[model samples]
Target: MTDTCVVVPTIREWECVRDYVANAREYGHLDRLFFVLVTEDFCDTDGMREMLEEEGVEGRVFDGEAREQWYEARGIEEYGDLIPAASHAETSFGLLYLWAHERFDFGVFIDDDTLPHDTDYFGQHYRNLEHTGETLAVESDERWVNVLYRNVEEHGLYPRGYPYSAMDEEVGETTEQVDHVVASQGLWTNVPDLDAVRILMDGDLQGQAQTRTTREDYGEDFVAATGNYLTVCSMNLAFRREVVPAFYQLPMDDNPWDVGRFDDIWSGVFLKRAADLMGHHVYNGTPLCEHNKAPRSTFGDLNNEVPALELNEHVWHIADDAGEDAESYAEAFGAMADALVADDTDYINDEFLTFVGEHMNRWLNCLDAIETGEPLAEPTPADD
Candidate 1:
């Protein structure tokens, strides 16, 4: 049996955690799985720990203080500082800690609001990551695969961060099979991961009745062709431990810019670029999760997404150009960061780009610190 851990970052109450534990116990491989819950300062960590203990769930809840201690003990305290206290991207810290400490064979990520479908959720993810059998190899002429098309019955719907310009491009599919699956992205049954604009357009603004979108069965799982990229949602995602180095979810909150909500999408961009260069495969499908999305102001989400819209159009292309000459995931990531820093774009200013690029390199340094078991050297101040 492969060692697996589920990483969840949540600000919700204990009942949310309790439901996930129950779902895992009932539909997942509970015995083979461990849970790493990263909670906000407001959460009751003690109560959460007690609930896990009473439920016989092998898990630990990390509040802000505990996470700081974990990073400090590993000598990667600087990396911990990069993650904001109340952001969704804080899950990146949990993932790094798992890689550097627990060393699980596989890591699965899910949102606190999602529940596993009645099927064998963890088993399917494990099988996909393990590449148990042959699966379809697909590519798009547009260079981007809208995975939403495969998972949902609805037409004209795209996942968050999908390039608006590429929606009309032609798709070329292949029946070839590949065995190098390193990542598996499970689909969601209810309240699929759509952008705020889409949510508003579909619901209140358009005056349409709200509805849930369920996963449509697409016989067999498929992997992206060597050159194609897929939009990866951190929720319902599973990847082998080897990819963790290149899989740092980009931080969106607490930056000196207006951008937010592109963390996982951009992370996927870099991961896919690196995976393509390294001869690994990313699988899409199976192990559907029921996403009972929590209520939030759609207008606020729209505001957060506004600045990212333009960045989304160009970042994937930038990653592609930067990664073409790279030989490894780390190298590809480094190249991408350099490209971002060098880019002259009208939408994203130089100051924000420099900040983002600096953090990208900082993430790499964190991984190096873990591998070398040494503290990261202080970054030199830039000449003004």
Candidate 2:
């Protein structure tokens, strides 16, 4: 079908999955588009089937681990000479279509955390896919969101863009130039542009560490529209369906390449790299996001005589103790993750074996990293 496919890849975010599918339903292209939840089968799966059928969505369980791992192994072969290390899930999402591109046409891969800001723009994305068939990435027109990419280069663990000097207490600069931006709500149309995307994911960038964008104290002034490395992010990268079968074959894991890139950052690198080469393209719709909740205020450092860049509306994150600031505390909430996965007592044997094997594999990888790659044993595992 030369129609649009809204694929929301979710994990434990059941409460939000239906709403995301519903957002795609809002688009007039409901018939022309398919909204699916590519997720693991949860215990509460009983109502999903009827709910999806009732809502006009196609719910499918992706072999999350298989999809991620298969692609990694293939990537190990395809780009082995270059990738040396396997790309994580983020870098791996671009490969999801590795074995299934023939089934659909245009596609938008959104995460469970994001939803279309409004229906008008959501519909516009479908139209863009129908028209250009090019990757459609979203970038908010607001200055705060735009300024977050301050300094296109000198990025550290965060903002990994331009020179750090570019950032001050004030908003950096504005070019009026808006290509596909890679942020929290990516918009892509990967049809004929599949190969380019594969190369992009191979580049370096991130999203899970997005809170770091705020941490870096980056503003627009530091951002310089230069080359591929400067390509924003895929918070909202959409592609044509034909592109999937080519890249979706990778194996999923805590760390695919065995290298330590966060899942979101790995995906961001892929889109950023591709756009670096593909000439700039603007999305047709307005911002899919209006006001991104800022959990805490930013350190405007304005008193230094520099203006305090108002980071209104854009997503902001802050460091806080348990319950003092947020509900999604990784440390505090980690127990829930354990609880969620723990309920599966039936797989005790399999789970235990997998755990032992995984640890052994990590120790071996560590040996390999030291013997081969320069930085040996630096990147620690997530749970570690």
Candidate 3:
């Protein structure tokens, strides 16, 4: 059975769950829709779960505490602990941890604030996966799939983690250099993921503005994105289950960086490089989503810009260098982790390595448990 899983990590964004799932159903039936809400000690988990149940949406709601419990039970408390104490960070790890255990053939990740604008949003992602597989099998090594992200309400507005510096307008690279991409991202409307600095600097559109790149103009086509301009967000992206490993959110650090910042930037960079190494391609697709973002804290967003500027300049190089081995995606992932650790910058630290090691080990164990019908090792319960 083909199971499609969508994972949404939220802290207080509970209000939108019902509507998000409602729009999801318009595209296809989901096998499991996970809403992992992070709270202190898994507090109010039942309340939250009941709230979603009241909405009549079919999904499981687990808390941060339940995640810790799962990790301890699996004898990987250290690995789980490596996930930062921040709720946003915990939320990211919780989603990946669930993927490590769950069974599914396809997966989609969307931020709670993002809503599907088209009925075919889910189907388009799945179709791209199919196209990606066929392209890789029969087409060529250079072909890969990456969804497009078209931002609404603003022409130059891009997502927070987007490598706007690498836009084709500046690089002038043709599609031939970067062809056949499978994993792509869709764009958003209503406060598209642009930087605060740019927004303030431009001082344009206090409320709303017309967005660029509609499906009616471009149609449902998987256009080849220039190699220089590839970036994606958890806001609205999908991938095959096999590529889930590549989408693992990088561990958040205790440094000065703001919470929930730069994680997707790292993911986008790493996934693109991993796909390239595996002979898969990535793109920016045409399916659009409306991102009704909440009001922003200007100060926090400004602080986030510091790391964004540094990383946007160099992260891709790290990914590009790591993928030089041309190893399989799984092998390249470990290699990439090792490279990230070797760099040992404040962003990529000892804790991130531990997280990576545990994740890699768990992935193998997960496969073993499924193949041999043997359960994974767990911590011994204390005597009552």
lDDT of 3 by residue, 173-286 (tens): 233333345565666655556655555554634422233334433233443333333556667776665665566665454543443466666767777777766656664544
List the candidate 3 regions with Cα displacement exceeding 4 Å: 26-28, 31-44, 55-58, 132-154, 163-168, 171-182, 204-220, 223-229, 256-260, 344-384
- Local distance difference test, per candidate? 0.76, 0.32, 0.54
Worst 10 residues of 3 by lDDT: 136-145
Highest lDDT model number: 1
Q: Whole-model lDDT for model 1 versus the true structure?
A: 0.76
What tens digits encode model 1's per-residue C-alpha lDDT throughout 1-384?
A: 427777888878445656666766776577777778888767877776777788887777788877776776777777786677788888787677567654478898888888877677777888888774555777777888877665334545677788887786566667545656778998877676788887776674321216556655344577877778878999889988878878888878777676788889989999999898887889988888877777778777787778668778888887888877788788988988888888887774446666777788898888888878854432211100
Question: Candidate 2's residue-wise lDDT over 1-384, tens digit each?
Answer: 335555555554445555555665565455655544444434334454456666665444333443344334333323221111222233333323312333455666555454455455456554444333223222332212232333334432222222222223232232434443322233221110111112133341211222222223321122223232222333354554322312121222332222221223222322332233333232322234322322221111112101111210110111011123222212222222233223333331224323322332332232233234332221111211
TM for every model, in the order presented, reads: 0.90, 0.44, 0.74
lDDT of 2: 0.32
The TM-score-based order of candidates, best leading, equals: 1, 3, 2
RMSD of 3: 6.1
Candidate 1: regions farther than 4 A off? 13-28, 132-134, 151-155, 205-211, 217-219, 374-384
Lowest summed lDDT over 10 consecutive residues: which window, candidate 1? 375-384
Clashing pairs counted in every model: 0, 79, 29
Cα lDDT for residue 360, candidate 2: 25
* lDDT against true structure, model 3: 0.54
